[model samples]
Target: MGTTTMLVQCNCFDDVDVHANSVIGWQQTYDQLGAGHAHTTLKHLTAERFQIFRETFDKRIVQIGAAPAGRLCLAMPVCSSEPSVFQGKPLTGESVTVLHGGQEFFVQSPGGIDLLCVAVDIASLETFASREFSSADLCQLSRITRLDLEPAMIHRMRKHLERLIDNALVGEALSEAELEEQVLEFMLVLLDSALEWSVGRSANSTVSTYLVKQSQELALANQDEPPSVLDLCKHLNVSRSTLQRSFLSVTGLRPVEYLRALRLNIARRRLRSTETEQLTVARVASDLGFSHLGHFSGAYRTLFGETPSQTPRAR
Candidate 1:
């Protein structure tokens, strides 16, 4: 007799750091790019050898991380305010990012990005591929960083994965072994679709990913003394206009807006921390380069809808 014991979990998180840690068997860090309350939802179904999950976020988020070592992971956007960028390529319904075990990846979503992801053990995936594909096909699959599926194929895959989770949640009489077999078959079908269907080209990113990443790092590192747009342009060796356009394209925020948000978020974190004794709004604001306490409080309230003094109390 076949039996299945799949675990289903639905969780809501208010903090990006805590949300990143909620995923099983992955190392991920989520940075909130837009201000205001951050709310996220993750619904996952985990079986013996594979997992599928849907992630939804309310704020603009930049997710950086690696999947579990020894698993082949696939992720695609289901819905978003705008197409999310995956390693500098726009991720859409017809586009999927493929990562082998331990491959590092990054994705930036403007806001309200809904993504469905799947990860399966390498051995199980190899077994499935071996049966349905030639050796060359397997080799090519291993080399694929991204796969552009036919539109219908992407839709089918999404619906199939959703149905599997829905079935398991409804206490359908599907055995664990049976579910595993079905999931492996689904992966095989996806591979076959990739091979047989006419692949479409995904939209290219509007800005250079390196420029955005380096700019973000520089901004965060200088939170105590936020750099001006001129400084960023000079450091990047790009014209001010180019720098402005790049930040706007990638982050949906102008350079100044994004940098200010980063500093304010850091200050909010510090203010909310119970670990720091005698912490004050003035101290937090000053440490983050806020020279005027009144201005800092006003900006903080505008962004997060609460006064700086209330942050620690609420936390």
Candidate 2:
């Protein structure tokens, strides 16, 4: 595939939208806090090569959903005292963090934060592995958990990417393809040399509790139009059986049942909140993915001990 690239520099948060859009197949949401203006610059070097972004924002939180099932992201902070968290784990500025596609994660950054992030499509990495190393299975990149990259290695990689960006800015179109190849090659080598290998949980040994939590988070994030179970399975890279077991074990309800309850709760909140005064029960129910108003009313009553109509409307 030819390299698809974009370069953006701006002082507004809206301009950062291109970074997420350029990822080929992913969805992201950003919430900025405080009162200061933000500045961002992002560049996509190639379709498979890593994209680089540096931003300075007034305290902000970001939520990312990697819907496309074959990519991995690595992030390292360049300047910031506070660390970012991913899936409940803390990521210090000095170390490298990896996240898999088909998952939901968050990053919290304070004002004046500077971060360096790289995302590589798994297919590209695996293709290189099979042809050059003859160890495609060893790549196990997705299943591997986040690792801490050495400070020296992180600095070197950052500098290298910076140089590439600088070179590209000078209108060096001829070397774009070659630079893409070199970046991917270097990343593969770095992963092999700098990180220890471990076989992650098998399907049987997988903890359904964590999976259930992840599903709930995804569902809540999309409460207005929650995804079907099959969609959830695909985004989570898990089997239907696993998701079922997880939901059952964690919430004492099947996945579908839990989703119904979640929708009902959301509806209740909307009905009670002043912001939704103009919304009717039927409208709220339908908005939350309920097709039949009667069924939705019954489910809502059973779960909340009151019919949707009985819920207090905003005054």
Considering every candidate listed, which one attains the maximal lDDT?
1
The lDDT for every candidate, in the order shown, is 0.76, 0.63
List, residue by residue over 102-181, the lDDT tens digit for candidate 1.
Answer: 99899998777899998887897685465445688789999888877788888888888888777666665245655665
List the candidate 1 regions with Cα displacement exceeding 4 Å: 1-5, 197-315
Error of 2 at 282 (Å): 72
CA RMSD per model (angstroms): 22.4, 20.5
Clash counts for all predictions: 2, 0
Q: Please estimate how well model 1 matches the true structure, expressed as its whole-model Cα lDDT.
A: 0.76
Worst 10 residues of 1 by lDDT: 197-206
Q: Residue-wise lDDT of candidate 2 within 204-263, one digit each (tens)?
A: 424787787788899888866677665676688764545666787778898878887888
